[model samples]
Target: MGGSGWRKAIRGFNLCVYSPLAAEGGGDVGPPGASYDPPAALSPPDPPALQLPTPTQSSSGLRPRVSASGSGLSKRTCAICLTTMTPGQGHAIFTAECSHSFHFHCITSCVKFGNHVCPVCRAKWKEIPFHVSSDSPRARSRVNPVNMNRRHAHMSFQHPLLHNLEPCIFNDDETLDTTFKTSGVCYNGSINTVEIKTYPEYSAIPESISTDNFTILIHLKAPLGPRNEISSKNVYVDAEDSRTHRAPVDIVTVLDVSGSMSGMKLALLKQAMGFVIQNLGPLDRLSVIAFSSTARRLFPLSRMSEFGRQEAFQAVNSLTTSGGTNITEGLRKGAKVIEERKEKNPVCSIILLSDGQDTYLLSPTLHNGQHTQPDYRSLVPSSIRDRTVHNVPVHVFGFGSDHDSISMHSISETSGGTFSFIEGEGAIQDAFAQCIGGLLSVVVQEMQVRLECLHHNVQLGCIKSGRYASWVTDGRRSGTIDAGDLYADEERDYLVSVNVPPDHHETHLLRVSCVYSDPVTKEVINPAAVELKISRPELVGSQTMSIEVDRQRNRLQAAEAMAEARASAEHGELSEAVRLLEDCRKRIFESEAAKSGDQLCASLDAELKEMQARMVDRQHYEAMGRAYVLSGLSSHLCQRATTRGDSTNSGSFTQTYQTPSMVDMLQRSQTFSPATRQSNSKMRHTLSFPARPKPR
Candidate 1:
């Protein structure tokens, strides 16, 4: 108040107190002990709002920002309301320090009477009136984006569209598929990256089913908020088991009985074959073909009855190693036996075991069709691949370094089979055990899986990880993935990214569909759908979660980087390769799906440390590089996308290219030759283990 105004106000107060009419208009001096009441003039009206200067800097030296035009400001937001912030029609003053904007009255009120700091950032500010209730958005909700991701990290695959699920009834004998999915099986059993976490409470498994043919797992991960550049949403999945099946297999063993298969190698081969024989079911059929200078059917295809097995055992015992490897003749004869019985038993297979020592044979071994040389790239006839369950799985085993890996891998991949590089002598049994394990656990055939998202606002693409059989997408949110067979405990994992278009919803629906043919039932199970859920805009908990998933992704990035680096280094772009590996390190750092920075870095460093000019060493390094990349893939997928030696023409560096990520390589590698009539003489060259990979 001004001095004159103050005197007038004081005189007025004096007059009111002394006057008899006041207290009733109290007399101030006379009424010593009496209580006095002030006049109406004593009560002042509301004061004018004192607007303060705009804040230039905060306690932390963060400049406060004001939006004059306020383009992005929404009017609906008000700090005084103490509710969630929404954007729409509002004047706002955003403090750049905290990135929180509030109404003009909103902030001044808190500064004037309440705290001297920003509500969101907790930064100290000069005096201002900001009366905010404690019930306002708490520290957790108002925290920055990174902290948000850490809080809501739990995964959920909500109720799948519950369309047609018959109340599944189960007996005590039925169990969940656990073995193949349990440990580091997805990462060569010795990965130290992402931690595997399963939210069983968030999962829904159909229990009490009378019979379980196969299963489909779904993982729908997304940030709880708008996606940022550093992290992308991903999905991890695995399914099916191997411990439940009575399906009979019609198997033909094609052995490379060349001179190379002498001594202990021959003994191990015999023992491996014997193990398979011993494990055969009564209804299963087996045909043994021993090939050396020529192919001989040791025993024609026959059911494994006691007498039939005894006779087959005798025939196998009488066989002896001899001349050059006529792999074509063996597969040709084996194919005939398998093709005839395919109609009865869909699971027909041809196992080719070779030492690859006959690679230099000038005379090409001939059989059913054409006199083709013993090149490993010889394609198996379509007649053999078709007409059987999925395709006649032409499993090939490469014993000794001399084995034709190119041909062996070709046969296995062409017919969706497996190729095992049996290192060391007498390791044929290990290869055999790997092959037989799958053959025995076979259940459903022609299995195909698809992941379909129903929302139009979001799209998921660049799916990596799972690539065992094949993966085909429909140019949008739906994908058809190959899941060859339902084994006793074998699993397949898929990692896919989410694409957020404008107008994304708070949640999304993910559909996992599996179609397969039950071997025993002889019935086609088409379109078995499983449902999953995705959280909208990951806020906190998810950002730091599932370290194991991150490791898997890191492995993939490192693998791709290694492949590219080797390609560059081989072409004398050593620095380029180094840069690529460095890029891989960054990718590993930013990868939200998998994170194994230390392992990948250490591995690459070790490989570079061993850089010598030895051709064999280089080749091994290149192959190891490819394997390291593949190591990130699901076990089944890595096996399917196994490297086919070196790919580029400029130099020898192994580069693995699956159709999903490397379509050009797929087109180039997939060679098709016209089926010409065979001159009753030729060689169709043929080829897993759950083996632990030794770090290079």
Candidate 2:
């Protein structure tokens, strides 16, 4: 009330506790002018219920005074409790910006519980007058029956690990539970700021499921909220640039310097490495590994200081093509460099580029002098044979048509990374720039999701979590999903199929919980679990469906179709691949996503059409279409937006790369000079969308 923004000379009063029963009573608590005798000493043992005395007259024998500032107190009633207010008594009137007046205690009690809006007009209050004392009767009385019911449901059983954690509620109901009214529903305001919400495709399933199933879509994201200054740094995140803090990255560039990369390929690789080295700041560390028949470290893991950049330049320039391609060795050596780093940065990854198959694993029996046809199965690299290379992701780049895309795609997918197909002469640098851009903008790391069956009758089914790894545990009653690192504002959708049995009782089906580490604060956050409940109504009622759930289902189905098409094309079944792509496109058009004006559907439709056009013949698919399809599918499965097709076609990666002559001049003139350091250090590309088929 004392702030400069105060517009009225209104009196503020100490909040008084009111009984819910009194408020619920019909307007005849007593006849007009009737007074009830008060009890002797107020006892704190029971809830204090202050009843408003009739405004006919006061005990002091003073009549009420009327003022223009407020409608006379004798004629007014409290909006919340619907009780008369007497003038010159203890009660005071409070007015909001909308000119609606209420009892001081009623409005203050509402605002104290985080309801910053006027109860009558619902206008938001910018500045509240006084602080709420936690030990006040009004504050204690705010806990109504709604919150008590929710507490009973939430505390049914608590795990030792998550005993005191708050429960995440759906909050669509208007009952206004105390906890729901205080904090925004989905946002728990927990240690981790990321918001995780789950929605079942169908709100209510049939009670008698003779042979029926349901797929639930769970979404997780870091909400873009108001900006706050934490520790002398603004931690606010925006939609476009939501990086809370950039974690220092330790990256290894794995180059395949085989005979095939002798010409423009080698030149482009060096240029890409040069751009990467120039772009890194002093906080980031880098290493270089080049491989031919064997692999060796070209540059040790060192910070990107002035001296370190110069050393990296020399190491990149010394690269020469020789012997055969050894992609396995290159990836192994790259992973080793990161694991052997003396000082570990919070974020670490390896960038592997290969233009041919791994000859190290190809051993053809030599009956005569010439070699027989190599076993196709042996061509699959051993790096991904164990289903994962290492904890650090190896973002593999398959250069040109000859690169072993199956192995490259598997390597990146298995290691929780993305696969980029460098088809054009100059796309190597663009791909590397895109990869490095994602590494620099990482916001959350080491994310894990745990989904448990809340009901014994409810059964768990397959969970489609894209490229992230997931496994079922405890006799299929529980499961864990390894989501890995997420960039700023990135959202990953998971479609979990579940089976329900015919039961008379309504109960929760599953509970989802997320655990992640904030890259900036380095704090481990474990948010409360969200439940997916279902009801068995005897007579089915009209139920509203979530469009987002349908859209995610279409996305996964399209990804599966793309995978099937890619496999068909790889096996020389061009006609079948084209048919599959066409079918997927039609399904996308017919899906709810298309009707909802979702951009993802339009993008997928365009990509599927282009893919169908390219799948005309086996020769075309083998030349350029295979890698392109694999890369596109990889982008969709990982839920990470990536640069797809030619850089000219995809306007997202339009930054021009320096030519060979310009690269030489940049290296000689100290490219990352003080003046240019700031520009180079700024992240060029910030991934704004989840993994999709087209560039964002």
Candidate 3:
């Protein structure tokens, strides 16, 4: 009852509203002596300005303290610590590698404590400028870098970190061979239809006035996914080593004139020797080591000329097979000949040819009163490989599939040399010529190609670019392909499976980088990059792939498949290997990627014929596998050899190995001609972009 009485009394109690509108006489909203008015009639006082909490940044990984875009110097705020770059606030700098702009103090702090990688792209960050040669020609778009952190108005040319560094691979020699050649799996004869892009969305620009860096070409073929499907991107990075500088080569041919090479083999050897002699420039030197029961230097290293060449021809022909095969003696004498020029540091090569295993060996025979160095390890078929490890290279060719491949292969592999196998009875000559071609194809001494994936969607499977390449490395973010010694106008293809993004537009994917040591100067070259872009079917009306790309892609895929097939065949799966090639042919046939189906079909038929030989004869298979591995080239690669005779008879098949012919490109301009398509006339096309304010 008491609680109910208190509630009733509280309800009956009177109260006055307290607001700005309250009046003196109990509640009509008005000021004293003025008309009553509501608080809404008066302008609402602005609420206290909203204050946001400061965001936090974790300090674990590389985080950029700078932004990507900017205005004039000091006109922007620092992205790191929420401070402007105006006047006393700080100054800023831009890195071309990642194209990120940052305040001096903030970026310095980031570099010192925030790890060395770029915040945006996470690329290796360097503080110094490119340090281009003052005498070097600069691009019209290039501007002198500004130093905004300092008070001085002048530019400093002294970049201590990069000073005295020579142009690792810069040249203006337009006469270098630029023709892009390939063994056709699709289009052949000329590279006319190949579309080259410096970057997607840019027109093809000719390299008239250019920088001295390596030229990189990107061939993109983005297919239209089956209606409304987001299409995947297909890109190929084609890099050309345009710097042409000839270095002197000193060669020592170790020929096996054993009894097995008495007739056709001897004649082929003579022909192969003649071919080598014919291709040698006057500056090049050659020495022959004829080995039978005994090894002797037929002639010391001699300069080739009309008269000298004649004498060499007579000397090579003079070699007649009689005694047992002494391969160890041949290698020993050959190494001695090249080791003679170790001090001169000439490009030394030891080319060994043998048809049978080493059958005889005396301690170390004297050739022209000089004992063979180190006695070829005093063994049947062994040599001191250390000499050829760096300065000289030992290339071995097993003829007729009877030679000890284990011994010959080990010799070449240890010496950074190439090992090739010539099958059948009389193909030794062709094999020799091909060996010589490969020997002469040394442009970059120590070369490595890296594919850095720019986007997370794409990656590559690393494969050895050549048998001569040391090794292929798989990295966390990139694939490193070992490209041993690149030849003049020699194009090597690699197949990498790209995981396409789930249908995106305006996507940029991979970056190809080349690092090599120049043979002429021995300078380590690095930082060559090619940005790859693709045209998605969604962006373009029709999906069309040029003959050049179409053929190369097919060849690359086929080559990779053949490689797997060869491996499978070696494991006793002959049908699997043949199936690989068949599958490749079927795909090409269905797609109509080949310019001439008959030509490609003929090539396939020839390929299948060889592969079928491997299936029937284990010896043939071993020979083919050994050669394929040594060449580190595709199945379509038959340029070094010319075959004649029935494919079934290994003895009847004759091969003459020779370097591929090169097409010279004289001029590159806007003019259109059939010759331009065939030759290496690299017409550069400029990229399109809106004009921007010039930088100081």
lDDT (C-alpha, whole model) for all candidates: 0.42, 0.57, 0.43
Off by over 4 Å in 2: 1-192, 206-211, 222-244, 363-390, 501-506, 519-522, 534-538, 541-545, 651-696
Q: What would the TM-score be for candidate 1 when compared with the true structure?
A: 0.49
What is the number of backbone collisions in each predicted candidate, taken in the order shown? 80, 3, 18
* Candidate 3 structure quality by residue, lDDT tens digits, 136-216: 453112222221223222322222112123222312111111122221111111111111133221212222221122122
Best by TM-score: 2
lDDT digits (tens) for residues 1-696 of candidate 2: 001100001111111111112322233222244322111100011112211111121354221122334322223554443455656756667877766666565454344323365443346678654654434453334222111223233322111112011123211111112331122212112233667788877776666653236778888875332122111111112234332245667888888888888755665466567667655654578877778898776545766543344445545644556789877677766665655444566777888888898777654567679777644433323443343433577687888888877777877776767777776645656566567756765667789999999878767789888878899888878888988887555678888877777766475789999888866567788877788887777667787567888888777878888889988887788899889988988888988768889877887787787778768887777777877788788788887655456544652232222222222222322221111122223412110111111211
What's the residue-level lDDT of 320 in candidate 1? 49
Q: Mind giving the per-residue lDDT tens digits that candidate 1 earns over 231-253?
A: 11011112221122335667889
What's the lDDT for candidate 3?
A: 0.43
Among the numbered candidates, top lDDT falls to 2
Each model's Cα RMSD: 36.2, 27.8, 35.5
Residue-level lDDT for 328 in candidate 2: 68
Better candidate by TM-score, 2 or 3: 2
Ten residues in a row with the worst lDDT in model 1?
A: 12-21
Residue 70, candidate 1: alpha-carbon lDDT: 27
TM-scores vs. true structure, each candidate? 0.49, 0.60, 0.48
TM-score of 2: 0.60
Q: Which stretches of candidate 1 lie over 4 Å from their true place?
A: 1-244, 357-377, 385-390, 465-477, 526-528, 537-542, 545-551, 558-696
Which should have the higher lDDT, number 2 or number 3? Answer: 2
For model 3, the run of ten residues with the poorest summed lDDT:
3-12
